[model samples]
Target: MKKIVLIIALLSPLFTYAQNKPNKKKGPTTYDLLIGTYTSGTSKGIAVYRFYAENGRLAYLSQIDGVTNPSYLTLSSNNKFIYAVNETPKGEVSSFSFEPKTGKISFINKQSSEGDDPCYVGVDKAQKNVFVANYSSGTVAVLPVNKDGSLSKAIQTLHDDGAHGPNKDRQEGPHAHMSILSPDEKYLLYNDLGTDKVNVLRYRASNEKPLEPASTPFVSVKPGDGPRHLEFSADKKHAYLITEMGSNVLVFDYDNGKLKQKQTITLLADNFKGQTAGAALHLSPDGRFLYASNRLETNEIIVYAVNQETGELTFVQRQPSMGKNPRDFAIDPTGKFMIVANQNSDTIYVLRIDNATGKLSPTGSRLEIGNPVCLKFAPAQ
Candidate 1:
């Protein structure tokens, strides 16, 4: 009995140790890449991919179909819901319930955008209001978000119709390009590319009609600038507006829903000037760098060093996007990798970002997708 007990005691510790051993062969860290595409071509709907960060590789997972022309996508604050613009003449905004564990999304419901050819969708910081920008109709729609992640009918549609910009062809009428909320969520700013103005709307999430024109209704940029997108500095004191037609970045001093132009800089080199249109602007997670994408002839990313105190930009380096007509790009959560969605080339290029110098180097990894217009990332489960 004593011998048997000794053997059992020795084996029990070994068994416990074996059961409690740490997993040395750890699984690769992965992220969910949600791609929004123009469904006019081969793309049916939103495409999802599993991005292996360690190797800079992407594996196709699944796609959410049935929603047409989901060219832009945004997520709820809790990461429980996703919203996309239907980008049709009869515009709509669709909602989906996100499954983090499986990296799958289920359609919830869609609501009328109250305007034509909706191009951008964004959720306010409070997550109680959803906003959409209609390009063709030159209107901004505000809808209330239900607790269950569904959207109510638009409560207000603000239209901007007035004198057109200098570009007679593209700016004949009001063309609302993007709607973005101030960092504090106290104000909503919509960029009107056709009107050459940025409209500021006072927002109160708790109100029945959450949007009202601010004291200063709109701020006019250069006549032909055609501001398409705006990004706020981390301090909320500076705003950067990227002009689509002019291919320039405008810096503004922001305070209490007013924007004063501070400086304007061109996105291309001084000597080499080919056709270039600014497509997108993004500030790095750390606020040290600002990146702007140029489509048309340039097809490159212009990097600028951000002055931490002044919020001014110093031109850094421009890197070829490795594909044609780069429409949008996103920086990974870790700030280590950036993925560019080239709309014309039908390819997604992965590039490594140098944290110190704000330089981008290609990872030689690319994924082929049709008409990819936007790239968004969510943390893996």
Candidate 2:
């Protein structure tokens, strides 16, 4: 009887883990998520958390200290290293080696971003280089990765020469908002808010200098659409982009390793329209749904049913973020849940997905932090 009891206890967790896997009938994948936050004003660093998709619960894991304003995080393809954007208007990018066992991060190294206020960072498809978008200076930089997954000094930075829009206050200077890796890793796409164009660059194997634009910077949304971030489809045939200043989503036709605009749709609530409200856009892992967040007038996520063939979007549903000013949010690896970091309310909220309808429901688990800006997840062994 004692042996049987021990055996059952040992197998119980396995059972739970099995249950966390995808249920085809239910249509959602259970995910384990690790999130990093912007600890501004108080700590000026990053915070990590473990989100369990099965129960919609977030477990506080570990943190890295002495780092200032670690705002955006990018995990390597092998999940061995984490690259973060330190929002020091005059700051640098920091790298941390990931310990899968404890979900902890050890500082690896830091390098000048080649410009000031780097708000975004991305690892290339080859995982040999890092790209940063510096907002204040309107520049995009490329840094090489060291052998041990640490960082080498930034070798190149590009200052955007152009400006756009009629509004003097918002369009006064160039603001490079995000740096993203194309699926093939052949090109680096930098979304510039100030210029309303996606700065494109070709990555060369042998780099004397890696900072020049590949072709001309690809023009995205119309002037003042202000594209902020972009995500490619799983098949790499289409791209979905979001505009922060204009509150719109633009679909693009992608082929021959290039992106061309297809359609643009509004991401605002019908009854409430005053100013731009959209912030971030992400596609489901299955590539069947697209989720976008709105901040200014209403704090909620707008869901769209995606047509996989043409990359078009149809309205699905909208769910309140359950917190204020969701500056950024991330979907878990398993695709079962989404965690939103509310910057204004200083809390993180968990939401459960209804797979059939593609809607979100509050999970009632919330963590309070100061200026939670970015979130990511690492695996738990």
Candidate 3:
């Protein structure tokens, strides 16, 4: 019967279509890891690695040698260039052009940081300026970015004049520790470790000197808090600060260039008391959780459940860094693994991330490097 044949042909075509449709395309399985170090020990300079996403492993690729203390690093928005702080008494900033495909970097140029012991470096999205935080001199310098990805001399330097904190030894003078761009890239916030203040500055990418003090000059924390680093929420409505001396995470409601403290939480346990020093804090990729690293006696990653509505944090669980003095950690682009750098132990460890519970478990993967303090992840290209 012709009618029966037509039905069979239609059903056959439908079955073929269903069978030919390919399975869901998989995501990227590899990324590039950039490690910044103190460079005083075995590390030659900045090191690069190829990271396997599926199994959370790392393979060393190449490194730039003979550069002095490339301690803190920041990449341009396009990932085409990188800037690092020399972190010496006569501080300097170095520039390099990066090739995302081959994990190779070429030195471009270097410039004076305009102060002593520059510790942190940041670059604007448009590559117009590179900012440096000078710790010992307590100053912030803005250097113009050359068209060829090099750095020009600092155009502006602002000295921190805030009063010192109560700690006599550590807070003898102002010490600028870090400078971070806001989520929207509209403001620059830096912390003074010796002044106990988080200073916010308005940013304009096109200007020769791109930073200006915000309406609210600085937000004062407890005298001995020693704010070290600050991380803002993905939505730009909240901010979190970790103190180096006091070892507390402070929550704040962030608005147009202003911060209002809301809640403060301690990173140390009640019974275990030795020493406390908070280093770095970061919000998870999905913005559902916050992770902070505590150095000194407690070498652990403290997790917290972020309250989306109220911009507050509830304690999650603590995971050991599996090494000594965890300085900084980076979550892979896929958000499946965490890479932690142990400056004292000279080891880097990878941990598996639980998407559901905001917890971390050791992946048993480790890389041995000397004085690894910072870890950053980018696409392998």
Q: What are the runs in model 3 whose C-alpha is more than 4 Å off?
A: 1-27
Candidate order (TM-score): 3, 1, 2
Lowest summed lDDT across 10 adjacent residues in model 1 is found at: 22-31
Q: Tens-digit lDDT track for model 2 on 236-266?
A: 8888889888888999887644678888888
User: Which candidate comes out best when scored by TM-score?
Assistant: 3
lDDT of each: 0.91, 0.79, 0.90
| Among all candidates shown, the one with the greatest lDDT | 1
| Candidate 3 per-residue C-alpha lDDT over 1-381 given as tens digits, one digit per residue, 9 for 90 to 100 | 999999999899889988898666756778889999998899989999999988898998889998789889989989899899998999999999998788998999999999999999998888888989999998999899989999989888987775788999999888999988887888889899989999899988777677889888899999999999888888889999999998899999999889999999988877877987899898888989899999888999999999999889999999999999999999987888999999999999999999898899998999999999878787888
> What lDDT is reached at residue 170 by model 3?
92
Candidate 3, clashing residue pairs? Answer: none
| Model 2: how far residue 243 lies from native, Å | 0.5
Clashes of each: 0, 2, 0
- How far off is residue 301 in model 3, in Å? 0.8
User: What's the distance in Å from true for residue 29, model 3?
Assistant: 3.0
